[model samples]
Target: MSLRSYLVNLKQALSSRTFKTPYRIVTGNQSADMDSVVSAITFAYLTYSLKTPNEYIIPLIDIPREDFALRRDINKLLSYHNITEDLLYFVEDFDKFLDKSTSIDLSLVDHNGLQGVEINKGFDGGQVNVEAIIDHHADEGHFENANPRIIRTCGSNSTLVFHYFHDLAAGQEEFWESNKDVIELSLGPLLIDTSNMTQKVEDPDIKAFEFYKKVLASDTVNFTAQSNYNDFYKTLKTAKKDISGFSFADILRKDYKQFKFLHDDRVGFSSISKPLSWIANKFSIQDIKDDLSRTLKANQIELLVITASFTQKDTGIYTREFCYYYEGQNEKYAELYQLVWQQLELSTDLYRSEAISSLTNGVNDSGSHLKIYNQKKVTATRKQVVPIVKEVLEK
Candidate 1:
């Protein structure tokens, strides 16, 4: 079946009374990046095509429907493939299923944790049985009992899902003919996540790419011939960094993660694609602090960290910045700040350049609610920084 037909069928199934128990919700991470969203959609489509008794496969993007606009890359890809919002379900839609008297099974993609409830408080009073997981991140062992738990340190979860379809399409020419769009759409995420197969490309990702190329070679749909990985990657990366319509809060929450830290305090780490100087120029330091405070209070968080990365428009050099914020009266927050400060100061490899701890030069002291750092010579990702913060919090 074509993607349009599959979407029509899916919409019908969602509204139909015949869509009985054993509903399978294929979901991705709370951040719902391009890779996560595509993996969930493709895997759920593949599962739906593979016949199962009374099982309705639904791809659930792990964010609100409105928030999808914050991810321009995702919107661009979906538009390119003619995917409409009506054909998709978001985290908020799960509540209706929870209220029903039906058994729900969850199939996680892109991430291997209980992200929907933990991050967004989406699934409430719902008894969900985890049936499977297909991911590429380091395992958190959240669903060890889930069957067919496929996890690897690959570039993208879409590549992992590609292997599933590739293996099934072997000697089955009809499978490729029926699901050509799925095969083509899946390639976008693989290329984007792997940086056009240049960065973080693992063995599995390469194998999947080769297998997909072979399938595309044999494909009569003529879709693969129209696009190349490099061009696609450029378009996607441009869109990924485009934060035109989003507010500061929307930009912060677009790719945010919350963690349980020392003494059960909630800590949030928000990753922004733009540089700190750009943000500072757009909004005043006081306004930024007020926004951070609002986010913390709304989420009931104790500490909030914002990490920004950008390229210098003049020299084309990449740089990073880290901003820390908390209510000044919190003792634990102060201790955590000091711990992070001390660690960054000692580590020459991570902080080879000077660390700037002031929002105002010589005007505000270390006890200020907001602290900004250059993080010079250190281009550590959240994957690297989160563990460091966790270690200090633990100590």
Candidate 2:
């Protein structure tokens, strides 16, 4: 069973009478990325091979199938594996194809992101049962009964999936012949996430990397192996960082997460792989703000925080920026802007860029009421910022 053909069958079966009960929807995070998507796919494939009678473990791409093309890096990997876009199923597929209502069993991967009837428009309001969890993020202690709930601080979730099924995969020649394309494609994220097994590299990730290398070295395997590891990592890294073709709106939703604050105020944060100065310079500050405001309104979000992170192309030094916008009248919004900035300033986790720490220097103070600051604490992430935002909204 070629992985491509296997996926084709799964997608077709969703529409047929065989669309049975207890759909084990193995899925990644909604804010999907390479590591998360591949981890879900890899786990689903592993489970499919080892499942009991009538157990269907379907790998559900967390993003819509329509928006799949936006992920250029994923597209590149698919092209590399000769897998077509139509072969895979998305969150929207369950609604489009299933004839009878059925309960869904979710197998979480990468992140503990639950996609139930409330959040998933394509669920048809089915009962959601979380069955399993395999991830790399810090555990939030939800889903206590989830079997095989393996959570650890690894460099990438893909590594965990590969290791979980490593023995079965290595021993079976038939498995390699059929599933090599997907299993091989899984390496892209693992390599890119760990910086070619050089930076932020962990023992499990390194072990998996070494294991795959030896597997490829086998004479029986008919897979196409990359000649240069550096080249392979560079290709995936470049694909992820290449935002040249994307508009400002596309960039926002590419790696975005939204939350509900006080009074049901919807807030969003987008993590871009490019620096703020580069984006603002190329797209223009006003144009970026205009596009962001329109997007925020369309999504019913009151405010959006854009966190730009990247290494300088010239200097080769990594940095981050905290850019924020609150949608509405400039006159009324300006009052809230000062207060929120006051909260951010008070927090030790964040600080103004060295250039303008003394004043409200980077603020536009115009219609958009936008502010961009070079984040002093580069290591501080959204995990550190979200609680502060919730506190700010309370006051």
Candidate 3:
């Protein structure tokens, strides 16, 4: 069966619970970024050999169906391949239903460990397994028993996914042409995640990036591979950064993750793709605080670390803004704030404003605390920030 048809059928069967047990669910990280989403789809589709009889090899997007729309870049890429949201299963489905099912197997992708998911071994005799892992993150050293546990540092996990596909189709002469759409879908994340091959990737040829570049270049000779790839990357990045249609809450949830430190400090963090100044202009401080307060209350978090990233329009420089905030824990949370300030290495000066200072100094509202930074280090992603914050929070 064609991969496209298989995805459609998989989604349908998932909705009706028509599939058999012993599901080998391939899942991405909870962040549900492009790399995670594409890797899950591409990896699960290519690993049919790993499937035994009656065991379903399923690709699960680690986000809710409702929240899927918030991932504009992912939607755009999938839409380009004519893969509708109806043709996919989400983590919400896995969480609510399949997680507790008896016959289940899991393969970790993009990320190596279960972040927010708790696997429930349904019934005493039920079988639950962590079967395989193919990732590009720093190993959290998990699933020691899973065969073919391949982990390596790379610009994108989709790059690793392409390697898997390339290895499987090594001797098959017509494989690339037959699975053209899937090949392109897998490459989209690699291009975007690597910033059009401008950062964090090496040995383009060995990585299949060179071959992927040729595949994309064959699309048209009007541009060089770098230019063609850059255009594609920008298209996805633009769609992701276009947050005009979404509410503040949806924006937060789009790329949000919850963190728990040693002090039992539950913190919430979100990285939005728009400028902080733009956000401030669009909503009042009260509205911002109210939404933040509500989010903390709903998630039971002690604080929210909101970050904003964008390209400077006139200057053409990429910019990142970081903020530290908490709702209603002044006495105890003061220690939390101090530790972060001392350990934080973004090298950013505070973007001082009257309203910002109020929250930063704990003057205006006891209900919230806020400190905004210019964040000079443009590439310090959540992967880097998490460990730094986690280390200090523990101390």
Taking all chains together, each candidate's TM-score versus the true structure is 0.86, 0.82, 0.86
Compute the lDDT for candidate 1: 0.72
Ranking by lDDT: 1, 3, 2
CA error at residue 215 for candidate 1, angstroms: 3.1
Candidate 2 colliding pairs, count: 0
Cα deviation at 286, candidate 2, in Å, is: 4.7
Output the TM-score of candidate 3. 0.86
Per-residue accuracy of model 3 over 1-395 as CA lDDT, tens digit each: 55677787666766675666666688888778888888888777777632342235788876678888888899998887778887777856664555545567888888876655333323223455778888887787778987768888888888777776677568763556566666678777877877777788856324577666556555432234446566777888888777876777777888987766778888788988776666665666667767777878866788788877778786887877777677665665566545655444454454434434544443236666666777776667777677767777777
Tell how far residue 219 is off in model 3, in angstroms. 7.8
Residues forming the 10-long window of minimal summed lDDT in candidate 2: 351-360
Model 3 score (lDDT)? 0.70
- Which should have the higher TM-score, number 1 or number 2? 1
Give the alpha carbon lDDT tens digit for every residue of 184-252 in model 1: 778778888777889889998898777667667655353453356567678888999888866677888
The collision pairs in model 1 are: none
Candidate 2 lDDT score at position 169: 51
Candidate 3 lowest-lDDT run of ten: 117-126
Q: Model 3: residues >4 Å from true position, as ranges?
A: 12-18, 49-55, 117-128, 204-206, 215-228, 314-317, 330-332, 346-348, 351-355, 358-364
